[model samples]
Target: MKFKTLNKNSGKDKLHSNDVIADFLHEHLEEFGDPKEDILKALNYVFDRGGFILLGLENKEIVGAVVINDTGMSGYIPEHILVYIAVHHNQRGKGAGKKLMEGALKLCTGDVALHVEDNNPAKFLYEKVGFTNPYLEMRWKRKQ
Candidate 1:
């Protein structure tokens, strides 16, 4: 397996646009994208801002992908956030996801952060990669 990075100007020889990344996220993550268009827009914005979209591949087939933002507001320490990640269904339980997460963590130059669902088995993998559970996430969405 190998890891590659994509930027705003990166070619599509390996993968297409943010839409492709969003599709991968939707496949393995619940509540990933109710209206995927929103996810695509968000992804493009990240790319334009010099963020990262990393892909994990094995012999030219994508096994996993991760979205990371390395910069935030000005005057800050530029801590990175691992916002989204997923491994292909057929590729799970074989350490592809763990390798992807580990590679992303190592690629970051600053502190990295990510959120795992309470019941997500990937929590173990994240821990294995040296991530600690430091905070609880709370969310409130306006009723539709």
Candidate 2:
């Protein structure tokens, strides 16, 4: 599979748009994904703040995708947060996800991190890709 990286300056038309990438992730991430709007917001963050979007394509169709957002710092926090990663259901087990993960990791200059639920099967893949659970995350959400 060929890999494509998109940034704010990438062409706005067709497959280059954040809308397209968001749609692709929304569909491919299945039960593990957030809503398309949330995915779009994250995609926007990469372009507006700092980060990147990577696409794995085979025969011009997206087999997998990744989004990484730069934390804009180092040392205390990971330099990047792997915001999202998903492989097309039909493409799973074919090394597409692994390739996407490795490709994203290779592009980053500093440490990268991601969050996964304990029961999410993808956690194994993340672990296989060298992500370690060094700390337990706690979040306090405000009532809407």
lDDT of 1 by residue, 40-116 (tens): 66567556775677888778767788888756643443377777788888888888988888778777777877767
Q: Alpha-carbon error at 17 in model 1, in Å? A: 2.5
Q: Model 2 off-target regions past 4 Å? A: 9-13
The parts of candidate 1 lying over 4 Å away from their true place are: 9-14, 30-35, 73-78, 139-144
* lDDT of each residue in 67-103, candidate 2, tens digit only: 9999999999999999999998898998888899999
Query: Which residue pairs show backbone clashes in model 2?
Result: none
Candidate 1 lowest-lDDT run of ten: 69-78
For candidate 1, give the lDDT of residue 109: 71
Residue 84 lDDT (model 2)? 96
